[model samples]
Target: MKVLIIEDEKPAAKRLERLLLSYDDSIEVVAKLDSVKSVIDWFQTGKMLDLVFMDIQLADGLSFEVFDHVSITAPIIFTTAYDEYALKAFKVNSVAYLLKPVDDEDLSDAFAKLNTLKQAPETVNVTAVNSMDQIAAAMQMLTRQYKNRFVVKTGEHIRSIAVDEILFFFSREKATFCTLDQGKNYLLDYTLQQLIDMLDPTKFFQINRRFIISLRSVKDIISYSNSRLKIVLDHFSEQDVIVSRERVNEFKAWLDQ
Candidate 1:
């Protein structure tokens, strides 16, 4: 099988190639390209490829933009760092979606899916243009719905809290809670993972396993031990909030954006 890999990160691209070869030594990687422009240019050359492993976010822009400029027919398996909601969107068109740091088992599963699709004549004949249209429709669906407010029950009365009024969300004792800007905390029914899909990425970020903080909630940032940074939020002094070491780079990139 001839494969083309489009990934911005060099290390991740290399790791994917290693996994592919380990799975099947006869599999040949034709080329590795990064960025939307590079991918478009490569596809225009009319190279013969059996499959493609693509990253959703490239250096220049979203890899979906590549389809706008060129038509691709090879089966694609998307590798992305996006949460499950975004993965659900990609499933509308791609052969399969794999989360980042692609596991060997997941890779095998994706290949199995591809083989099954190839065996079905009706499924194998689906054009790439139709897939592109479905991708656009899925993205529109994802962007149109974002939770604007939450309804909470306080005693016998129920009140709605706007997302702007909340400072942060945290998990303790397997229960979730949200703190307000005015020094009030409320028990929430949704878990931290659930909130990741509901909340907008620009406003809320999961700094660590225990905390998902808003952009306005950051009052101070102090460098902590072992390359981690301490986060200080208003009205939330229950514990020290620290960005985990693994997420440090992504946290910094999010802040810069």
Candidate 2:
């Protein structure tokens, strides 16, 4: 089987190559590409391949842009860091996706699905085979459908809080709440985990398991003992929000980005 890999991170690309070779000696990697422009150029060559493993977010832009510019017939298995809720839509709508830090069992299962597809009797719809459009649609849905407002009830009076007015989300006494700029906290129905998947990663970050903070909410950053970091938020008076030691690097990267 001839395979192509499109991933921006060199380490991830190399790791995937090693995993593929280890899984099946019959598989041959045709090429590895890093950006949307390079992929479009590769597809223009009209080189036929058995399969393609791609990352959803490339260095230049969304990998979906490749479909708009070039024609590709080979089936693709997307690799992403997105959560399960967003990924579940891909299987039902079109292509298969594996979560990042890809595992042996999942890679094996993805290969198995490719085999099943080859042996299936009927010809799969070109639109549905790759489901490129569906994948794009799902990606759009994830970014677009973020909770814009929340309704909170207080003594038979209900008020809606706009997402833009929120400062941050934190867990208190086993319930999740969003703090407003004015320092009011209202309980929310969703868990911090659910909100992490839904809220825009660029805007909100899960600095700790209990806290998902917005960029605008950060008042100051202080280096703490043992190499951890403390976060001060505007109008948040409960306690200091600490970024766990293990999460410090990723939290920094998110802030820098």
Candidate 3:
């Protein structure tokens, strides 16, 4: 009943551990790992694991990388927030998959499958073609976070700025600008929406289509009808920032957090 959990998110990993411990004390959680690199190291070190609750995305790379160079003896249960994974291929190999915000029913079902796997006869290795496809697809989706500082070119000089220095990304006159809390503005050669996607969601909130406001930029909020809200930013803006009726609840939750 030994198990390993490979998840990047701290909160998610903790929650999963708590749930598993709550479910059965007999299930021994051998290790909680964050990246493919570490997992490879663990294999090289010859760790004994009976089962794996693996996440597709990791800090360094995807979990598929573990399968690429090494044969995993333990069966894996794929856990992900999104359902874009190659599930058909996993099903062919008799691997179980679970989508996140995992509930009690899903957990119970996954455990049933786990128990069934122990009783079933051994099968052939996962198909080579499907494995190759999964690895390639994983590589395409794996991207590094913006760490330390990023460079911005201005005429003849390149300016290095820290990620925290960026206060807000806004589109004005069909061009995008990066404004700092110090009131310094720099024009970046990227769309506001694109910038929004690049930055961490926890750090930046898209107040509207044209504005990707930072956490510090949120100065105040006013309630509106139909569960809508209006937010004011510390940075200058004549245009009123309104949180859509659909997004107001989420906005309020985020604001509280």
Candidate 4:
């Protein structure tokens, strides 16, 4: 099978190429392109491709913009560091959504699903129509407001904390707590996952399963063991904050943005 890899990170693109080749020696990676502009230009060539492995957020813009300029009939397996784009990804020719640092098992499962779809060509048209509908819905969802503040009760006193004033949110013993700049901790009734969807992504990032840190909260970033990163936050020393290895790349990208 001839495949196209659209990823901004060269190391990641190379790693994915190696994984694809190792999975099936017969598979040939025809091209590797980064950025939305390059991908749109490549697709305009009218080259034949059996499959495509694409990244949602490219260097220039979102990969979804490519669909606006060209038509791609080949099945795509989206590889990304963020899960927020999962719903929008399926609105295209996406066959699977694999999180960054994709492993062999996930690749195998994606291919397995692709094979099944190949056997049932009758559903392709239906999928295409549904994909367009979902894209519209996903766009509408993006316009919704993100949480700007939180209300917390402290000993019969109610105080509203601006989201920006909170340094970070962490989960401990099955409860979520946000720490303020003045070193005050407030218990919140939302899970880490829920906070991720409600908080503005530009301001907050869920570095791991336990912590959702704001950009203003970052004090220092140090390299950690196993390609992970240790984050230092102000007034919070209850536990060490580490960025998961899989999320390191995305974390850096978020910081740069």
Q: Residue 132: error of model 2 in Å?
A: 4.9
lDDT, residue 224, candidate 3: 70
Error of 2 at 201 (Å): 13
Predicted structure with the largest lDDT when compared to the true one: 1
Each model's lDDT: 0.85, 0.83, 0.72, 0.84
For candidate 1, what is the total of clashing residue pairs? Answer: 0
In candidate 3, stretches whose alpha carbon ends up further than 4 angstroms from where it belongs are: 1-22, 25-51, 54-64, 69-143, 147-159, 249-257
Could you give candidate 2's per-residue lDDT for residues 109-212 as a string of tens digits? 98887677667637543235456666677667555667778888777899998988989999988999999989888888899999887786777889888999
Per-model TM-score versus the true fold:
0.59, 0.58, 0.54, 0.57
Candidate 4 on 118-160: residue-level lDDT in tens? 7888875423522555545653454558899999989989999
- Model 3: per-residue Cα lDDT over 61-85, one tens digit each: 6677787767676777778864432
lDDT string, candidate 1, 1-257, tens digits: 99999999999999999999999999999999999999988989988899999988889877877877888888888888876545555575577888899989999999998887778858665235237667786556444578899999899999999998999999999999989989888999999999987888767889999999988899998999999999998888778899999988888877875
Error of 2 at 239 (Å): 32
Off by over 4 Å in 2: 123-127, 145-257
lDDT-best of 1 and 4: 1
What TM-score number comes out for model 4?
0.57
